[model samples]
Target: MPATRTLATREAADLIELTRSLAVNELSPKAAEAEADETFPREVFRMLGRAGLLGLPYPEEYGGGGQPYEVYLQVLEEVAAVWSSVAVGISVHALSCFGLAAYGTAEQKEKWLPGMLGGELLGAYCLSEPHAGSDPAAMRTRAVRDGDHYVLNGAKAWTTHGGYADFYTVMARTSDDRSHGISCFLVQADTPGLAADPPERKMGLTGSATATMHLDDVRVPVGHRLGEEGQGLRVALAGLDSGRLGIAAVATGLAQGAFDLALRYAQEREAFGKPIIEHQGLAFVLADMGAAIESARATTLSAARLKDQGLPFTREASIAKLVATDNAMRVTTDAVQVLGGYGYTRDFPVERYMREAKVMQIFEGTNQIQRMVISRALSRPAKGTITVLSEN
Candidate 1:
């Protein structure tokens, strides 16, 4: 809870404090019970919306906070430290809005942007399908052109905020051209033919609903289309670049939470007539955990800074997500180990932390996919590579 790093602006500092207050007072207390019950805390999201936390990274003219990605991500980390489900929900909502914000027509923005950013309407991203989780380009969800609408048919898998979202930002195939066939649509949650399947029984993030959304003859107006017919893939990929950073921050926060718990327990729990932290064996573990958490935080923030500067951050984003999430998995697991048998029990939250941390490496693209992204980026030539003439 102590200051981990200094803020660039007073406003950023204020936002962090506000988020911390909410996380400590509201989120942390209810996380255990809600996760235990597998209940989605819908009202808590509304409270966050009302507090102007939901739209931190969007333009201020559209009722958002208009903060830099760097500031917004840190706020996300603060919330994530207490309740990861809520933080992940926040990240998905931001991603759901990205297409419209970045690609929608001015008229569309005028009509829907304010309400979306104002927090009255929670949003979900629907790009992944059952047959195509990693290779979204191979998706088969179809959207046929109707008189004045596009009738969507197919299912989206692993949809967060599935049944509860007020709106869904969906991507569906519109043509046979594999590279340029998809399009984005903003569909209202109450659309007659759209329904969420039963939630997936998950190992972690139980409080966050994940379900397959069925689009059975769902009709969205042509006006709801976000960009050109073939631009959906581009929009989705660009959004993921930022979304990866969000997950990175959340992963870092999760690691920090686990580390804090382990440290506190070490200080209080004694072994061999002294605090276990006094023993070099256990002390080294705690030290390594601390080091990992800080490293993850720095990697994530560095990516955010690049994003804030409008630099190309695709590689950095993947790197951040990979490092932070992998570190989170390790740190949370170590926290459980540090607690010895007590950590494995439900009586302690380290078990839950370990469970939650596992999914961070899997979602927002798997760590395997992240490595692919990083390596592919590496394969590309640099923008400026100086060459010196050499005689062999």
Candidate 2:
């Protein structure tokens, strides 16, 4: 079933329709094969880029679609419904651009934003290290200043699009001050000494590659530095505020997809001389799933609206991430139950959906981390307080 969204503009509605069409025609048909083959759908991304779907939340001057975050997130949701790996790739690409788009100077934006947002160049974010997944301040990666460049040495773990990305937005320590010592850099993939480890074999989203990126004295020009030195942590956190919302939107979409599948299965599969949907117990489960999906979607969109309004939405974003992902985990699991034995096998997509939903709780800051963020925010006086929780 298509989501009945109350969009703010006609253009937004049209965009969603276009995204649905694209997902149906381009993403859905190939999703299973790509995942089965563990193939990264690079051409699909390029196709989305050509269709102006890659840079929806960025400014138009830099070859972006210039759509608001609300519209962009909905497009992401629509895409996620059909192909989660592609949706995750789009979200990560947006995150990779966040530091540069939000903090880069005019010259930096003019020089790099065009290609980066143009969809011709894919990007990866490098912040999480083997030991520093949640505590970014504890990261050991270092970027020492040279005459005209910075020599970076450290490994970033769990990098999406790791081996295939055209550029990387990296956060590395530039000084001894844990919180204030980090700096952000835009590093080209072909830079000497930079390499990607073999992709991790994952239980789900196999079509999207995940690998550790090794930066062994990789030299990046000073001009590629984003924002001021010692301000990388701030830039990274700012990006994550938006990234959490992206994940929230994706989670809601995943739940919605699961709910739709379960509802359809219940309606068509007869049991006890009637459709299972007519059974009171199964009917109640479907009702709960529908309510959960609606609630998750509402929470996610509310956060996006707060962000679009330029309000302090860190707490709301965390809540959205926590609620939406947890709901997805539950909803997808129940969707498999709705399908009975078929859901457990690869013959149906619900099994894949269930597997894909698991990681949503783990990434973009774990659900526990989200709770910590919410708790910290609640502890503070409510006078425009924004909790600064570190996320990778």
Candidate 3:
């Protein structure tokens, strides 16, 4: 979970209180234990489900919470502040729902969306492959139509909730075409020839099970394929466009949490017969951290609002992801400094936050890739900036 603090909101005060109450009572206490054991907390999700948090940011017609993206992100922020793994679980679940929600037909939605949104049926998104990490065009997972069923055979790497999820949203090559050949499928976990390996040990976010999924001749009905046979790339891209904002939100939450921890620590720890927070040097650092958080929050919210307004936000989303994640890495590292030796050990969460921050910079198309995206968007040059004015 990402660390967050109480925000100013009299309107959501009641709801926020309720959200925090459950998080403190149930999620926070078990978070460290779960990370230590490298175990996924299945029951924790169920608890969130009962509280109607899992369905947030979706329409209420299909068992959703009908909340806005802004509200939903803050909720996620609160959850992450206490426990990042579970917060990431919620993020992945929401990601898995993307293709189905954006591309699924009425029949498909009616048949599958309810249980998925129920919060009990965990979901995972399978797009990254051993060969294809950032490049989806290079994906090798193949899905061939056998009679009325699509037989899939390939492997997906770095799948969160891999072995534990109820279903997976898989992207597979349906034809020889690079971009248009791919198709998305909604596959149940226990389906024959579909296997999720044991979780891979990682440096951080240990409580969220990350593993590889093997699909050896896994067959599914044609109805399960999301959208048109050639529309998988669009579905994947669209989902990712939204998904990146979710990550930005996560990054913001983590940065805020780290700053909060450092701030609290600074106020308590003293040197030279004064609290460390009284030192101009440390206070300036805290000021910088707070400034970054505020900026990150602003950028992230701007991107999300643009998305919710149906504007072209690829560049904006990339900007938010890049800024927020980079901020997290910096904030978390400085948080460790405030805690001194204690921060370096497992006794403090600052170290864990640091580890978690590294991955945020790497994933969602790495901060490097985000820069590439922004550059590409900028290279457009206003459709011909240096217009020659030959007088007529």
Candidate 4:
């Protein structure tokens, strides 16, 4: 069952309807089989690209949908409810495009943005390294400037769409300055010395590929740089603020899917000569699941509203990410319990949902990292509040 949504515009409502229709007709049928086979659904992305769903958050000038972040996240949620791997891929794709879309030079945008937003080129973001996943500032990747190119050498770990993407947004150290040493570049996947290592064998989301990208003497043209020197970290963090909201939307969708499945099963399954939903204990659990999903959705949307209004949303984004993922984990686990023995077996998708929910709490800066971000923000005085520095 789809959750009721109140979109601000008829166009947004139509977009959501289109997304839900496509998800049901095209994605849901193949999701289980592809996941079971651990096959990367490259064609599915292309299909979505053709449907104009790949670039909903981008401007229409670059062949995108020009939708607001709120609408885009709802579309993502719709897709995620049917196929989480695809939904995650969509979010990662948006994240990959963020640097160029937000910081690229006019010439660079004119040259590359169309192809990227049009879906002619798929993108991957290269930032996290094996030893410096959380601490990007400590990354060892180097990009030495040549006459007209910057030769890169390092490996980016846990890259989504790794080998399959056509372009990569790479961040590498260009100087010794810890705070301002990194630079961002748009490197073509076909560039020499740029290759992806074998994909990682993960516990879930197998339908989407994750791998380490190796940049060994890969020369990226000077023009490919997204922003000025030493601005990569800023761009990366900004993108992550938006990316966390995307993950929150995906997690909410996953929880919704699980809850829907459990609700259907519970209403159909019998317990003590009545439907399991007739039991107060089970009913309370369903009620909690419904409440959690709504709360997570509201939190994610609130953060998105802040972003859309061009306000400071980093703290809110982290809060949304933390709350949504944690609630998803709970909702999915309860869903499994609702199905009892069937949920434990592969015959039902609740088991897979449980596995998929585990990773949501781990990625996009783990929930622990999110808590740190939130706490640090809380330590500061509120925007309008005056702080009196009095020694205790």
Candidate 5:
């Protein structure tokens, strides 16, 4: 089933069609094999870059597509529907660019933004450490300044596109102040003493490389630092709100893909004289899956709109991440059940979808952590002025 989207302009509609075509012709055919072999599809990314899909949300002046977040996310969703690893890779690449684009000096933007945004160079965000997965304030990575360079030492864990990326946006402690000590840097992948450990063996999305980055007295030029000396955590957190939205869109697409597979199976597979889809019990299950996918898509797009409008959407982004990922988990699992014994094997893609969906809830902030963020936002006092009513 094709997703019915309400696009805003003719350009947006055309972009979607172009994305769908690429997804169908290029990504879908290679996804299963690349994933099964645990091979990274670097060429696909290069192709996407050449086609201008890699920089959809960045400014055109810097060689980006200049589309709004809403449109970029929809394109991401289309890609995810065909190949999730590529969609996630694109998101991480965008997250890696966020600090420099949003906080770096004009000189830095002029120097590096074009290549990074143009997709000529893939990027990775290095924020999570083994001990600081949820609490970035506790990260132990240190970067001590010495004249013209900063000597960095520590490890970053669970970095997507880790070994394959051309550049890294790294965060490290620069002082003793828990919140204010951290600093961000745009480090080249080939910097001395900076090495990536072998990629992790995973449950799914094996096509997307995840590895630990080790920085052992790695010297980064002071000119590569992003933002102020102590603003790393702020920059990381700001990028995450947008990153969460990207994950939400990918999760929604995963759900949609699984639902489409299950629906088709229900229409063809029969336990009795009629198709299983005609049976009330199985029909209702399909209905619920459809509803969940639609709800997740709506929530994801609504959050994107809030972000595009320059509103405070941190709370909404968390909500969308939580809802969409949880929905994906449920939908993908039920898709397997709908396929019966066939779903448990590799013959169909639903099984792979199920495995891939499991991680969406855990990354970009776990669903549990998302709840904490939402509750904290709700507990805070409103920021804007309040209006008082007079007696009528």
Candidate 6:
């Protein structure tokens, strides 16, 4: 038997089935339109929220699916296979919810958890700044302690759902102790002095809003602090680890979706004497794409399994994120090749998939960061090395 089945639980299977129906019936149809218009599908997100797809992997007590991370990520992969923007947005929202789930007080959970999990309120994570993309220690966003609140000041860059989210989990400097000086806050979007700096024109994932968030002396109550005063870096890093897993899932889905399109097109599109599927050259490319997609899926699922088992998944997650995203870029580009001239034009959906794949490699701490994480995970020792004095 498999160490752990990918789709074991009936609840998980049902949730996957539901998401598939939604993806095929709703997401796939509007994907092209959304990408072309560069419009955020706020309503589509609400539809997913209503379907309870947004809450997969969360506890049922909070109006969530209560599914395992493995299953949830697979479902995420399915969503991404059709439209990556939606899949990534869902993952980012889940990352925003992490602070409360892992570190918030019970009262805080009772108050904020339901809306976030229910998808009634979207979420945005604010850790990267103009100066700090992968380096949190260089963050300039400051949160000064006041009587009962912290005054937040600075801009958060490349924030997904920037203006659209109901909440933002912000990380800002509290002291001059580098990374340790950072603090995390659950700042509502309705808070005064918080403004989104217009959506950016990006290479892909245009359906998901991306912008800079300006915090002008915004006051976040002391009660809204995620963990301890100076524990923000820990929280931010944890969120990033989990976010990398999410990206891995999305990347796998994109690859699979692109492969499926290429396969069908190859089988149907006739050339020369017969269908292109009969051609050895094109067949080899399709086979490689298939292998890459399946491998990415397996790797991503393994990382999720490690996370679910409460094991150290840092290395596994980084590996998954790195491999899956790179595969997505390759698979999508090859898919465009499969379509020949049609792929190059907006007339075909392969062009959109190709554009979306580029961001997957760049976001969620970048593939370079993933390599660093994997290296550290591999290089670290369980305990400090000690030298025994040899007989001299």
Identify the candidate with maximal lDDT: 5
Model 1 lDDT tens row, 1-392: 34386898999898899999999999989999999999999999999999999999999998899999989999989988889999999999999999999999999988898999998899999999988998989999999999999999999999999999999999999998887999999999999999999999999999999999999999999999999998889999999999999999999888888888899999999988999999999999999999998899899888898788777899999999999999999999999999999999999889999999999999999999999999999898888433343567
- List model 4 lDDT by residue over 1-392, tens digit each: 68899998999999998899999999999999999999999999999998898899999998889998989999989998888999999999999999999999888888888888886677888999999988899989999999998999999999999999999999999998988999999999899999888889999898989999998899988999999999999999999999999999999999999999999999999989999999999999999999999999999998898788777899999999999999999999999999999999999998888899899998999999999999999998876523343568
Model 4 clashing-pair count: 0
Q: Cα RMSDs of all predictions?
A: 4.2, 4.1, 5.2, 4.5, 3.3, 5.7
Cα lDDT, all candidates? 0.93, 0.92, 0.85, 0.92, 0.94, 0.89
Itemize residue pairs with steric clashes in candidate 2: none
lDDT (10s digit) by residue, model 6, range 1-392: 00123477777778778888899999999998888899899999899999998877778887777888888898888899899999999999899999888889889988889999997889999999887898988999999989999999999999999999999999999999985889899999999999999899998887889999999999999999998989999998888888999999999888888888888899999999799989999999998998888888889887887788777788888999999999999999999999999989989788889999999999888899989988987787765334443568
Kindly report which residue stretches of model 1 are placed more than 4 angstroms away from their true locations once superposed.
1-3, 383-392
Candidate 3 regions exceeding 4 Å error are: 1-13, 381-392
TM for every model, in the order presented, reads 0.97, 0.97, 0.94, 0.97, 0.97, 0.95
At residue 270, candidate 4 shows an lDDT of 99
- Candidate 1's TM-score reads 0.97
Error of 1 at 286 (Å): 0.8
Judge candidate 2 against the unseen true structure and give its global Cα lDDT, from 0 to 1: 0.92
lDDT of 5 by residue, 1-392 (tens): 97999988999999999999999999999999999999999999999999899889998988998899999999988999889999999999999999999999999999999999886799999999999999999999999999999999999999999989999999999999998999999999999999999999999898999999999999999999999999999999999999999999999998999999999999999887999999999999999999999999999898898888788889999999999999999999999999999999999999999999999999999999999999999999887633333467
Candidate 5 all-Cα RMSD: 3.3
In model 4, where is the ten-residue run with the lowest total lDDT? 382-391
Report how far off residue 338 is in candidate 2 (Å): 0.3
